[model samples]
Target: MLSRSRALPAAVLMAALLGLSGCGDDTDEPTTTASDSAGATDSPTASTSPSETAAPSSARTDFCAQIPKPAIRTALYGAAIYDEAWAPGKDADVRGGVHAEGAEFGCAWTAKDGTTVTAWLFAAPVSADEGATLVKKAGAGCEHKKMRAPGADAAVTVQCISDDDTVTRTQALYGDAWLSCSLQTPGILTRLDRAADWCDAVREAALV
Candidate 1:
C-alpha cells in the first residue's frame, strides 16, 4: 500500500516547482559577543547567552554536489551562466516542503535567463501497483507518456504549458525511492526528452 503521508499530491509538487526563484547572497549581521562588549575582558566567569548559541546544522548538504555541472548545462540548453538556486540548509526561498518531507535531497539550478531545472528524491516505500497509480495521478491534465530508463523501475514524463512558460516534468520510481525532475523555461517550448535526461541523470547520481 502507498503511504499517503509520504506521497505528495501533484498540485503540491507543481506549486513547489513553479514557486522556485533565485536566491540572493545572504549578508551576515555583525554581532556583539561577551568578549566584544565594552569594557569586557576574557574572563572565565563570562558566559555565553542563549541567543548566542550556534544554530543547528543542516540535515544534509552534499545532495547538490552529486550532479555534475555538465548535466545541468545540458538540461538548461542555451543558458550561458547558471547557479545553484537551492540546496539543503539554504534559505526557505526554494522548496520548503522538500525539507519538511525529509527528502533525501532536493536541488534546483537557475540560469540568468530565468530558466530553471529542479530534481528531488523522496524515500517512499510502495508496491509497483501503487507506484503506477501515483504516476498516473501526477501526469493528469498534461501530455503524459511512459518510457523506460536505466536504473528506474518505472518512469513517466509530462509536458505542460502554463501562461508563457513551458514546463516539462518527469517522475521515476526505483524500489522505495521516488525521483522527480522538472524543467521550466520561459517563452520556450521544451520537450520531454530533455526532462527525461535530467531525471535519468539524477537517478544515476542519487541511486548509486
Candidate 2:
C-alpha cells in the first residue's frame, strides 16, 4: 500500500520540474530522480518505474542512495522556523514493484513542539506540479493563492483546511531534478503561514 502517510517538505518543487507525471492519485505514490554532472549510476526507488523515473544517462549519473548530508543540512538551516537538519543515516535496498535498484534515505525535520518528524526521501521523479495538484485534490481542502517562485523549473504551493483546527501547506521544487515537501498539522491559518514561510526559505537556501 502507498504509505498514505504525510509527504516530505518539497513537493511543490517537484511538480514544477517533473511536470504532471507525479500528480493525480496519492495511492500511486511517485518517486524522484536527478541528473548530476558527475558520472555515477542512478539509484532507483520502490515507486519509480524503469521508463517513467529513469533520468537520461547524460542528465544524472551518480547513485549514492540519498541527497548529500550537507544538502539536507543546508535546507534545514534555511528554514525560518526550524534550526535542525535531517542527516542521511543508512541506505536500504528495495526491489520489485515500480522499478529495480530502489533505495531509501532517512531524514527528519523539527516540528513546532520541538519534536522531530522522522521521514525518508524516496528517489523517484514524476511530472512537474503533479504532487501539488494531486495533494490538493485528495488531501485537505484549501485555496491556492499564487505561484511562489517564478522562472523556477518547478515551484508551487497549496493551502488547505482539513478541519476547523488544521491547515496544510504543500510545496514542491525541481532544479536539475525534483523534490517535494508536505506540511500537515493541527492549527489554524497561523500554523499554515509559518510552515509555508519556513518552506519557502528552505527552498531558496537549498538551491544549488
Candidate 3:
C-alpha cells in the first residue's frame, strides 16, 4: 500500500543511490534551475492557490474514464489487472500535497505481482510558469527529462531506481489541467521506457 506522500522521497533517495547528478538541459527542451527545484519543494502546496481554485467551469473531473484498459495492460507488461479508483474517500487513500486536497480524478491499477500504476488528473487555472513549476516539483531528485506530448504545453518524464524497485513518473500540462502517471515495478526493470507511452495514451485521450 504505497501512499503518494512516500513516493517522491523514495525517488529522491534512489537518485542519490544511483549517483545521478543535477538536472540536465537541451537547447530545444524546457529547462529548470536548481533554484527552481528548491523553490518548488519549499512550497509543495503552491498549486492550490486561489487562482487554481477558480478553474474553468469545463475542467475535467472524470480522469478514470479517459484511460484505456489496454494502455494499463501494456504499461504493466501484460500483468493481470485490478482496476481501482483512487479518490480521496476511497479505500486507497492518496494523501499529501495537492492530492490531499482532492484531485479531479485518480485511478490505480494493481498487477498480479503487486506492482502498481497510478494516474491522477488535477484541473486548475495554471499559467505556463505554474505548469513548469509543478513539473519540476514532481520530478525532483529523479532523472527528469523533457518530453513531447499531444495537447501539452509542457511535459516531463522522471525515472528513479532503488534496490527493490524502479519508479517512473510522467507529467504533462494541458491548458488548465495537469495529468500525472506513476509506475512502480519490482527491481531495476527496463519497463521504465513504457512510462512515456502510457502517459501519451492518457494525454491523447484526455487532452486531445
**TM-scores, in order shown?**
0.59, 0.40, 0.65
Ranking by lDDT: 3, 1, 2
RMSD to native for every prediction?
16.3, 11.3, 9.5
lDDT of 2 by residue, 108-202 (tens): 34334322222222344434444334333332234564535533554445544333223233444353333334433333444444545544544
Two-way TM-score contest, 1 vs 2, winner: 1
Instruction: State the weakest 10-residue window (summed lDDT) of model 2.
Output: 32-41
Backbone collisions counted per model: 0, 42, 0
Please report the candidate that would top lDDT against the real structure. Answer: 3
The local distance difference test score of each candidate is 0.45, 0.32, 0.50
The TM-score of predicted model 3 comes to 0.65
Give the per-residue lDDT digits (tens) of candidate 1, residues 1-208: 1001212232333333332222110110001010000001000111211121222121122344677768888987755243432222222322223222222235566566656676665432444564565565554456665644666666777665555555566666676455666666665464567767776676666664
- Tens digits of per-residue lDDT for model 3 on 1-208? 2222211231332232232243222110001111111111211243334264454332355556777778888887775445544432222222222222332345566676545566665534555676676665565566665555666787767765555556566666777666666666666556545767877766665653
